[model samples]
Target: MKCIVGLGNPGKRYKDTRHNVGFMAIDELIRRNHWELDKSKFNGNYTVEHIGNEKVILLQPQTFMNLSGESIKPLMNYYNIDVEDVLVIYDDLDLPAGKIRLRQKGGHGGHNGIRSTIDHLGTKEFKRIRIGVGRPVKPIPVVDYVLGNFSEEEQADIAISIKNSADACEMWLKKPFLEVMNEYNS
Candidate 1:
């Protein structure tokens, strides 16, 4: 079994913010798969479904961005899931809008959600899918930038990125992470 955890703050207030892109990708995945996330457990919402004969769990952490691990760790523990079988999806400021990158493992790179996951999981060996939200062009504070909504043009790009990120998640279910990375990273 593999678990895909999307990191973001919960509630409608943050539903469309830049920091919630992870949630957006997960939303896309849920929609494309027609999976019903009607169940609640492990400090978030989740649903299990088979994809290409593999049981896959889709999770959206409700512990908010900084406390993401609080949701992920418990679920992983209950399911006996290995770090290698987990794919964390979140936003990245290092790349431009509409871009995505996958990695086998790495440090959080200043993302509160990833940092929290690393802390709770006790390892950075898990896989990750990063959707590029881009850094602020001017002098806005990082917090403000990440929590802010996208511009009209950026909204279009982010919509595409969200769909592509979901596609990357589907690819990971059937292919090796490295293979998916090679195919999607550029």
Candidate 2:
């Protein structure tokens, strides 16, 4: 079994925010897989589906962005899941728009959600699917950049990135992590 977390705030106002890209990708996965995220479990909306013999839980932690680990740790404990079996999909500021990266584990790279996950997990050894939303033209407050909604041009690229992220999550569930990293992380 594995736990897949899509990091984002919960609300209509944040629906189109760059930081909410994680939620958008999960939306794609749900639609593509024809799964319902209606149930409240593991501190968020989730559904268990069979990916081959594996039982995978698709979770969108309602604990919000920075406090996501609070939701994750409890679920992990309840299910007795290893840290490696966890996959976190979130927006990446450093990467360009439509760009994607998949890493097994590392430092947070200034992402509060990622930093929180690492802190609670007690290790930087988990799977992550980093989707790019690109950076603003001029330097701005990190909080504002992440929390703000996307522009028209940004939305176009983000749509593509979200689809690819959903596909990558499916691929990760169906195959080895290296397969996804090699094919999509370039």
Candidate 3:
């Protein structure tokens, strides 16, 4: 089974925050695939879609951002999915707003959600799609910046990125990850 996990805090308050861009991408994927995350299990919300002979599982951890692994680990275990078949999508403050990058494996780069995931999984060999939320404009606290809503102008860019990220997820089922990365990471 191929698993796509989106990291974000759970709650209506965090719905449109920069930190929830991961959730937004997953939302786009669900819309594109015409599926609903009707099942609640493994501390998360999930739904499966069978594409050709492959089963694709889309997940949104309800355990929040910091403890995302608490949900992902159990779900992966229950589904008998390997680390290599997992792709985590989350926000990245290091890149420009709305920019997206794909990596085969890497450290968390100080993202608490990614940190938790790496810790629980015991490896960084899983795939990742980092959607840029942009750095703070000034000396504002990082927490406040990430939890803040996007600017009016940024909304457009972020929306486009979310759509593209969803498109990339669909491409994963059809091509090698390296090829998908090369095509989308540019």
Candidate 4:
């Protein structure tokens, strides 16, 4: 079994914020597959289903962004999924909006969610899909900027990135992750 985790804060207040792009990508995947996150466990909303012949669990941790690992480690333990079989999706402040980057392993790069995940999972060797929300162009605080909703101009780009993220995930189910990265990252 494979696990795909999207990191974000829960609740309606954060629904469309820049920090929630990971959730947005998961939503797009669920929509494309006609699946619902009908099960709740390990402080996460998740669904188990097949993409092609591979069984996959799609998870959105409800422990908020900073404590995401609190939710992911348990679900993974219960499912007996290896660290190698996991893919985490989250937002990246460095890349431009509408861009997505895939990496097989890396440090959190100052992302609290990824930091917590690496802490609990005990490694930085898992796969990742980072959706770029971009750093604030103005002088706003990082927290406020991440929590803010996208501008109308950015919405179109975000939409496209979300779709591309979902597509890359689906392709990963059928092909090697490195191949997926090569195809999508280019």
Question: Each candidate's lDDT (Cα)?
Answer: 0.91, 0.87, 0.93, 0.95
Tens digits of per-residue lDDT, candidate 4, 35-137, equal 9999999999999999889999999999999999999999999999999999999999998999999999999999999999999999999999999999898
Stretches of candidate 4 exceeding 4 Å from the true structure? none
Candidate that scores best on lDDT:
4
lDDT of 1 by residue, 11-125 (tens): 9888999999999988998888788777699899999889988999999989989999999999999989988999999999998998988899999999989999999999999
Best prediction by TM-score: 4
Q: TM-score ranking from best to worst?
A: 4, 3, 1, 2
Cα lDDT over the full model 1:
0.91
Better of 1 and 2 by lDDT: 1
List the pairs of residues colliding in candidate 1.
Answer: none
TM-score of each: 0.97, 0.95, 0.98, 0.99
Q: lDDT tens digits, residues 1-186, model 2?
A: 887889999989888888988888888988988898977865788888887787888888898899888888888898898998999999999988888889999899999888989988899999998999888887898789889988887777888888888888888887888898898877
Q: Answer with 1 or 3, whichever has the higher lDDT.
A: 3
Number of backbone-clashing residue pairs for each candidate, in the order shown: 0, 0, 0, 0
TM-score of 4: 0.99
Please give the lDDT score at residue 59 for candidate 2: 86
* Runs with alpha carbons beyond 4 Å of true place in candidate 1: none
